[model samples]
Target: MRNRHIATALLAASLLLFAAGCKKKTPVAPPPPPPPPPPTVVEKAPAAVISSFTAEPSTIVRGEASTLRWSVANATEVTIDNGIGAVSASGSRQVYPTSNTTYRMTAKGGGGDAVAAVTVAVTTPPPPPPPPPAAKASLEERMSREIQDIFFDYDKSEVREDSRATLQRNADALKTILSEFPSAVVSIEGHCDERGSAEYNLGLGDRRSASVREFLIQVGVPGDRLKPISYGKEKPVCTEESESCWQRNRRAHFVGVQ
Candidate 1:
């Protein structure tokens, strides 16, 4: 009987322990939402055409050069429409035509697109008639192209050996100036091949022209008879990168002055 009582007491104690272990609990929250989407942006160019949009010697034939000049404007970027390639960011460039073409410039900025254009008419340059059949240039006249103009290499502003030859011709002509026409004088206008900044190139033009003038004086031409001017790359006889155009750009012209 004692053993039976002890067993009943043990069973009652185990049941009470099982009831106590069956209790309840609580719940959890979710993470905060992600940040809002960022804003979008658009680019634009400035209003009105930039002054740098110009073409010099606007007429030409196939495969010849024409100088493109644009005044330095406040534009951030400048591009061309001939579909050649990326336009030089520098102010001006020389362009050659494969066919008849019109070139356009675009300035791009945060404002809008500014534009400019020039047309080149390609025509076969008229040939000069026969020399003996026609009147020939005098020693002074022959010396004009030879002496008054200093030519340069593609992309170079420095005076070259050929330029000295030009000076020599001018000096020879000047020896005859008083006998020919004492009141006449000549102007040296420097030009460049299109490949760099207009401002920088123009400055180079001045140097090149001055170089020619110095050479002429050193070789015996009267310094007082000559004037120097910088056209920079603004005037290109040819705009293409070909040998011919480059040759044309590298020259200084002697203009008649009274």
Candidate 2:
């Protein structure tokens, strides 16, 4: 009985082992579709290039104007510094700066960024003020300076022997002026001291003025050019009551009329 039972156990174990060997092993999966070919990593190209950046007139005077220009390629974004925001890829702008300045431009794309720069120079400005006008002479000063005045002795209307030289000089000046300006006219004024009465001095002054005018006419000055007038004691050069002052007050004055 023990032998028969051992034989049955051995046969059962043999059939189980053969069945396990005959079953097909599970097929291996194809490696999860190779992880979708690693998702195809693609590299992008570089950013835009700045072809040129320049100022039309790099050197400018103060308060003057200049144009800034630039050109870029293959960029998606462009910007300038110094208060300039986003801008086109290529363009120009007018700028007026009080001082020298530098400008920088930047370009950006999917790949990277690019940069460029330009500088504008400056010069000295014009002077703040103009030159002053030239000096000129006045007409009144010229007319008064040309003619000479003649002096006289105290209370005398007669032509003095010592006064001939002065009279000759006055006559020569008048003749020279009349020859240059045919229409020029002059006046001879007679003056006296305050010691005499107004009425008596008037006659003395008239005689003195007539004497000067006659001498000028005799020396070839036109009579019409010499107009005679009398001031009497009305106009006094010296107010002091003395011989010297009185002598100075008694004189003939020459004045231009035309």
Candidate 3:
């Protein structure tokens, strides 16, 4: 009976412990599963860095057009200040800016946003073209080869009747110049071919120049308007030994000095 009582007491104690353990209790579930992992919200990485931008023409001419384009390594969306033609884009777009303009490109996403700006300038047209005019090429001297000189037959040494018409033309040209430009000074250079001795040639040269001047004065040109010098054979328009060249050398050259 004693053993049976002991065994019964032990059974009762075990039952009481099992009843206490079976009582209703709050569930301690792993901190409520950490608040359901906060809805497993995982933010994405920020957008890439946009160091700068590129432009079609950084400095464009006043009449030309320019485009301000931007770029980012990786982006979700892009926005630009693109004034006057401002626009928003998911990736990229183009812009043609008229006047001086600046564009800011922004990349926005989980990793954050980057920015870059591109600028373009306008230019003005160049100055107007210039004009071309005539050059002022007037003669300060009357010694152009355009005028002809008259020569007398050798040794007879007088202005011949036949040469009078030729002398008249030369005298007329000189007279016109002396009358038109009083400030201009005239010098008549005389010459001779190589027929005579140098001394005789020199004297003959002077005689020829003086004769021309005298004829000019007789034809209404003032004597004070003429000055004469003899070149002899020292100076010749052409040095050829030909008769034609020699004849050309035997003449007076008129020059004007301002």
Q: How does each model score on lDDT? A: 0.72, 0.81, 0.70
lDDT of 1 by residue, 126-192 (tens): 6777569366455446445445556787666567865666567667866576346567777789887
What is residue 80's positional error in candidate 2, in angstroms? 26
Candidate 1 regions with alpha-carbon error over 4 angstroms:
1-148
Poorest lDDT segment (10 consecutive residues) of candidate 1: 40-49
Which of candidates 2 and 3 reaches a greater lDDT?
A: 2
lDDT score for candidate 3 against the true structure: 0.70
Q: What CA root-mean-square deviation does each model show from the true structure?
A: 29.1, 14.8, 11.6
TM-score of 3: 0.44
Question: Model 2, 209: alpha-carbon shift in Å?
Answer: 0.5
- Model 3 C-alpha lDDT per residue in residues 38-155, reported as the tens digit of each score: 5555566755666546778688767776755555665666667654333343334444555787776777656777777777776676776765445433455343533466665443
Kindly give the stretch of ten consecutive residues in candidate 3 with the minimal lDDT sum: 83-92
